[model samples]
Target: MNSNRLPLFTRADNFVKDLTLTSNQLLLIVCAYIALILNLPFLFKSANAITGLDDFNWLFLITFPIFLFSITLLIQSLFAVKWLIKPILIITVIISTLMFYATLTYGIVFDYGMVQNTVESDSAELLSYLNLYAVVFFIVFAVIPAVLICSIKISYQPFLKELFNRITLFAGATLITVLIGTIFYSNYASVGRNNKDLIDYITPYKGIDSIYKFARKHYFYPPLKFQLLDTSPQIINKNNNKHVTVFVLGETARAQNFSLNGYNRLTNRYTANQDVISFTNISSCGTATAVSVPCMFSRLNKSNYDKRLATSQQNVIDIVHLAGTDVLWISNNNGSCKGVCTRVNTQQIATTKSNPLCDGEYCYDEALLQPLREKLHKLEYDNTLIVLHMIGSHGPTYFKRYPSNKILFTPDCQRSDIQNCTQEQLVNSYDNSIAYTDYVLNQIIIELSRLSETEDVASSMLYVSDHGESLGEKGMYLHGLPYAFAPQEQTHVPMIFWASAQVSNSTPDIDLTCLKNKSTNVFSHDMVFDAVLSITSVKSKTHHIKNDPFYGCKSASFVPLPLLESAKKIQTQSSGEH
Candidate 1:
């Protein structure tokens, strides 16, 4: 806080000039400020959730801050040293303040899932969160307080005495928190049990815990050797006709908003008349791309998913590639594939040669269509898998997802501060993005259809969103709530399947009518692995018939004797472990 350099902050510097406090005192004050002021989102949400049937429980409201203050104080006391106190305090307060902006503005929960998404977000994606409101909040809460912290002089005692004092502070804070919890046991217990997500709203501590967990998984844990589910996957029922399937990994497209799935709006206008059928009931593996994208591609299910283990293994793409299929990933998404595309050949659109469709920061979903059209002509393999990873409906700039000329909905919200927009305007913008997605998909389908008819190749497409979005529902906006407390808006994603006549005529298992009838049945991202394997005719023990929606209608003649023998051998070999 050099007054000469930052002259505007001179008053702030002068205000704290005479303040000389012991390290313990400074720690307590910063902790208190952080717990109360920086935790407005936490307290407000908790109050809303636990106000009961009446106005409020005044006693519980008072005790909640005391609990938060005690928790923060105890955490800070452990790091209370003359040389370290102010630095640690400043860092924590600054991060807490930023987290405050996100939680307060978008109702985001700083759980491990969201921490993954935040860390992996690219510069452009990160910048979308910035606006005038965020800047003002940062200046008033973070910068000003940080300057004051640096300006205030910390008093020192003898080293041993300072250590003893810090120890006492730690003990006192811990005892007070424990005593408060014990006294308000019934109130705290009931509220917490009913509202489990309240734990994630404990200011920046929840975020700190998530970061620590992420670091521990990526750093502290021993390096894991890359493992494959099966190394001997084979393309079964091989034929002369080439097979092409476009696996469209969608972003933030919930099923509820899709007209194909009964939404009132014509969001799926292009696909409505196309041969595609939308899966009406399907949930995502996780609420954010960082978590969902990886899990959706891996040999992992939501119940047994482990981030470290998933990253250190061959995903569905690798298995398909290994089965002698030429696989390529084209991402219009800035949030790279979260390690899912590491082993596959990938092309990032935003980094390529200049295009009129791309505006430096973002490109419309149509930007994906031209390359897709060009690639369909260059096919040199019998079985081909092209993944079009779309940046669909990612906010808080939904208006940027599609072009102005393509805007199908009126009075769309065009600003990043979506909270300030009317609900109708916000929803209109989101629906327009959905309609644009249909147009892009329709273009890709037309290209695939041409290839199928002209080149006699079997063409098909499968589209599934990584997760869903929340458009100011239940006073919550955006996505990434903890999965346990996540609303359906963040999990019930759209999955659509479209196959040219060649796919059904060539691929034995793909009974389109049967699959469409089963579309209304419950399914999840776990089914993605098997569905892809079945569509591409890749056979391995890992491709469970039970998980594939097309398998019931699969012809028994398609199963080869050697594949059956291999399955038995693998099962017999691994049966001892269980």
Candidate 2:
């Protein structure tokens, strides 16, 4: 060959000869394809629940054109660069990096961070956006180069020629992919869900009004003008010795694991000593704070919560207000749901200190007492209702749930990420947070007791968890499961009440001993309204007298265990049993 041709031929031969693809590159491609396949099923699943807004401005629409263009460019680049494996891999890296960042950021933004306060009905829309961006961006900017690099790595021919051939082949594939996606979207556009269906499935006739009310409460700039249903509310037993009920809402505390409920561990050493009623079987209404907090506070039942959400006449707080008691809601959790305490006097401890325990400006549950004490001191009146919402055992940041000094376990006082530690370590960190909670409650009780003594006021403290947390059970890390399918851990939480001497004196015959030894297996957050009413003797017009489940209305239902049948034999010889 001529010298000029020799140089070109030799370079081509070297490029093709040296070209090879590694397991990592092939694996990446396979993974990307798998992701695409997986997304298709997800898209189909979410399609049924699509809203009109989704149909109109789906991410697939915008990404289709870019996807086509990207695939075309990638094909062309592949055949042009004979030894472009590194360049293509670099492109893939860029695309994957962008996707990784997008996914990570998406989790953060929704996890605890806020957006423009715009609500999207389907979370899949955001995921779809990310998927579309990844597909099109990779096809356009990364594919051809990646194919060229593979060619160089795998072939023994001229780099440029190999790149060209590979690009030509892959470009065809790229076009086919884009064409398929576009055609699918185009044809399915008219078939997707619409506004009427959204109204039907999510907000029915009765629910529409409620949905509108919820929207007004959370998103409506100018609030909706609505009147309280009961204008002439009658108070029951007006003379209850200036009753004060403090409901301390604990976060993510499981009842079964609590030592107060006979758990193997000493998790409830401090609470066990207190003069309190530990309702053993108390279950949360929902698994997520967003759903549970709102549902628990709202004057709605399981059957009507969705429908009544928007139009519920009043919440528990509002009921307290109408009953002539000062209502206060102090919280540390993210405002994911509607501000349940919006109408009530609200204080947020999470946003108070500069350096708080968790990610946000949220301090531990103990911080609630700081403002709570002040609020109590400021209150000149004897009748008041204070709701202390604790940022209890919210994980996977169990270590941050409590203070560093409160760590009871030795060797490691606390850990921000329990997953990074052993199972024992994680348990220790979690239990420590619970221990701190015990201390916080003790302090609140002490303060309340002191107040009753000093000012001659009557007070009672009621503690109920919004929901329980799961600690490495069945591959689930946190709460947010649908209530119907949630495990026992997510539902069962510690419910206790520590009353002041004056208040407990009135209910002198109240039995708290059985509460310590046995399980009140039928209790739920739903009974909260009636329980509060019964304890305070506050009667409201809406208080359903007959169906009120908390008023000595224990269900005569029990789960049968064959293993317990052996108790007959064991009991016969259990005269000396401890």
- The alpha-carbon root-mean-square deviation between model 1 and the true structure, to one decimal in Å, is 3.7
lDDT score of residue 326 within candidate 1: 91
Candidate 2 lDDT over residue span 175-250, tens digit each = 7666756766653455342322221111011222444555665576544344353344433433445656788888
lDDT of 1 at 133: 81
lDDT string, candidate 1, 19-109, tens digits:
8988888887888899889998888878777687243567777788888899989888877656777888899989998889888888897
**Model 1, which residues run further than 4 Å from truth?**
1-13, 48-50, 53-58, 160-168, 351-353, 507-509, 559-578
The total number of steric clashes, by the backbone 3 Å criterion, in model 1 comes to: 0
RMSD of each: 3.7, 15.6
Q: State every prediction's TM-score relative to the real structure.
A: 0.92, 0.59
lDDT of 2 at 307: 22
Off by over 4 Å in 2: 1-229, 237-240, 307-312, 334-337, 350-360, 410-417, 507-519, 545-578
Question: Which candidate has the highest lDDT of all?
Answer: 1
- What value does the lDDT take at residue 240 in candidate 2? 49
